[model samples]
Target: MGLSPVLWQFLVHWLHASALFPAEASGIAPYVDALYFFLVAMTIFGTTFVAILLLVFSVRYRREKNPVATQIEGSTLLEATWTIIPLAIFLVTFVWGALLYFRIYDPPTNAMNIYIVGKQWMWKAEHPGGQHEINALHVPTGKPIQLTMISQDVFHSFSIPDFRIKREVIPGRYSTVWFEATQVGTYHLFCTQYCGTQHSGMIGEVTVMTPGDYKKWLEQSNSGQSLAQNGERLFASMGCNSCHNGTAAARGPSLAGVYGSKLTLTDGRQILVDDAYLRNAILNPSEHVTAGFAPIMPTYQGQISEDGLIDLVEFIKNMQSNYRVQQTLVTATSGEAAPTTPSEGTTETVKP
Candidate 1:
């Protein structure tokens, strides 16, 4: 069956252009569509109205018809109508756009977090399941996913046009963006900021799949250690356990419950401890020292790689609630003995 005449006409007349070809797959897409179409319609109307008036006045007041040039002051009613109408339109779009902006920037509670590292020529994504991908992202449809992105070098922008979300990936600082996909499909992911020579090649796909399919894909990858587990390993190996593990001789504060908490710095300024704060604490310890703590931690700016730093951050995040380290002993299907972290309130038991 074909679409109804009215529906077909609406599609053809309103959305057949390039502005509407991209499907709305995220919560913010509809807002973008409305703002875009409203501007397009206004532009068309203004152009047509001005063109018609010019043509009519040129013929009506031509030198052959009216020899004397009539000079007159402008009409207050016409002037007020045009000025107030455009001002009102501008104000409405501005307010509407601001609301949509906040909706995209605010991360919802319980949203799955993903870390992204944008280098000179590629986009690297680190999932909590220890699955890492270069130039690609896999997410479950209909779930809100929050991305913490930072650049390894210059400024870069992570953008998904279909989702109508884009944010700057700044170097040495973290920026975040969030979106909830409504459809299951593959969409284009691009770096809108020009980094260097291979900027054009820094494009990839975001695959949105069903929850079941995403789970299957994670299992198939067989990543022995979760992101937090790997981070924990890195944490222990790097001697971070010496000071941050709640010891009397330790100089740094215990990071166990620091994530998402408001921290008071030595300078009397309070800051929220988020992904960016953690990253900075590791890379530049002197920047924001916690109150009552000496700045003894060495800066790891060039010593640690981006992936390693991400793992460290994840480990810190998981420490908030004694996060389980899911280590598969044998394949779940085969039922072999694999080492796994003890769940909260559960005793560790080993099978022969």
Candidate 2:
């Protein structure tokens, strides 16, 4: 049977106004509920006590009867009671909040990692398998998922109302958040940080699916091809190997094992060789010119689309472990001009 009219109306109102709506429940829901209840109790107790005391005092010390109120000495018992009660309440809150904080920060060992990049007004997410989504995130239900996020431009925030998680996506630094969905549905994603003029419009969705459905969706998302394979093809087609190959006396630095390693510049400076650095080396090589390297590397700023850069980065990352180019052999055999002496510059420059 359906709910009574009054009950239905109440339910509708509660769903509209309450944060306890079923769809909004996620990992942090229980702790959030606890805090909400605690605050409500505190509010009730404070208002009631203050109101009763005011009424009693007003009656007992009315100005018409006696304008000068009697000075009451403070009681040790009153001080002890207030101090002990608040200390006990604070201890309870601290324990509860600490447990939830640990749960939120420590992700499951088996959690699948996804990379998310926040730009001016959009979110670009990529699964390890190379499945990419813009302004949308997809994860299988009942499986833990971790998002490693960074912002390409100004500061942004990755927030999911349903999950009760909000994290800032800072530039040049990484932040992570994790969640395991209990239900299969689409949830809203919002940039809670005021990034720029378009911050309000930076919205997206998170789609949770059953395991079986997730597999099917993954297949569809990948279209039966691997991202690395696609990326390799793109790399070769774009003539990246001409300069980045091991054997080439190409004007550009060799990209072999460049991912996930430390790159030392011609100057004394060193920087981590990561996806962001690789992308920057491709799109804006002049930003951090290698110590011995000339600023001859051309920028691919508009030549490649955002997705193309992601593919390229993925390809380079995959090559991190298995890249086996013989630099000396390529330089010696290639008909392209080779450097004659150690003093001669050997870096190759590619025209965008």
Candidate 3:
């Protein structure tokens, strides 16, 4: 077989690759580029202005031209002008970066989630559909995708250069980052944090595919059960369904619609039901007990592994979506006010 001209060119570039910037494959890349360019332009302007000022002053106020030097006090207007101008510029950039950070951090309610476990030297990814990969992630383009990541041993960082998103993977805690891939291609994924002896080798690739192709891939790579399905089975085996199934007599609060909503704690503090909160609630139930619910649920601290905890979290996340859809349909059919009762028949303590 003969290699095509395009393939030969790609191979040549790969062999002679330099430190070139990766392509902007994510929706947030443009915003990141904007901030980067802003900094570069400011640096150039400040350097050029200072250099020109020095040159002009040296020539105009030369000792050969004028023997005497005139000393003038600084102008308050000039000082204020310089201070306020720099402060305003800093404020503008600060606000712009803050907005972008929030947009990247706050995953959409409907984003497809993938769990990631960062070990000492490798990245393990698990799709909600049960497909698993080592050091590689396959996601569909043009859709919001959230990664709930945790480290097994030391702290690690999940970095995708092309996506402009990086998050710390802390042990015993969950951190999340999200992005919508705008381009369909393969991009580099790396652990930017210094882990251990194999830190340099902790690298991977992120493959973004089209919607149709991604669906096909999922169907083909079916693991005989989805993550949520496995979670449901684990829930039953762990005796979680007895309380979380939304029964009136259950001890624990109903989990339906509780994934992202805020719940009033027993101490009257409202907290969002995110990954970290859920993980804590599972491993430490007495710490942040929900209002009107007794702290009777047993902790699953040493009993469950990190991967198992993630599976349970994924199951709860799916329940939230299902609950919302069911509520919407019920409201449409009844033509009355939305029911206060939870669809799962449980008197869960969640407020909306």
Off by over 4 Å in 1: 1-9, 12-20, 321-352
What TM-score does model 2 achieve against the real structure?
A: 0.64
TM-score of model 1 relative to the true fold?
A: 0.84
Q: Write the per-residue lDDT of candidate 1 for residues 266-321, one digit (tens) a residue.
A: 99999999887898899989999999888878888898887888899998987864
Q: Write the per-residue lDDT of candidate 2 for residues 1-352, one digit (tens) a residue.
A: 2347787557645864785563544656555655655666666777888899999978988998887877879989999998998788789878877887888888887988788989999998988787889999988877888887878789999998777788899875667888888777899999999989999999998998889998988888984435565666576668676555554456556666778778777677899986668778888887888766678777888787555676787778777542333323334554435434322433534422
Where in model 2 is the C-alpha error above 4 Å? 1-22, 60-68, 223-321, 325-352
lDDT of 3 by residue, 48-110 (tens): 888999999999999999899888888999999999988998999899889988898899989
Sort the predicted structures by TM-score, highest score first: 1, 3, 2
RMSD of each: 7.4, 8.1, 9.6
Model-by-model lDDT, in order?
0.80, 0.74, 0.83
Off by over 4 Å in 3: 1-19, 242-245, 320-352
After superposition on all CA atoms, how large is the RMSD of candidate 3?
9.6
The order of the candidates by lDDT, greatest first, is: 3, 1, 2
Output the number of the TM-score-best candidate. 1
Instruction: Report backbone clashes per prediction.
Output: 1, 11, 1
Given candidate 2, what's the lDDT at residue 72? 73
lDDT of model 3 at residue 139? 93
**Per the 3 Å backbone cut-off, how many clashing residue pairs does candidate 3 have?**
1
Using lDDT as the yardstick, the better of models 1 and 2 is 1
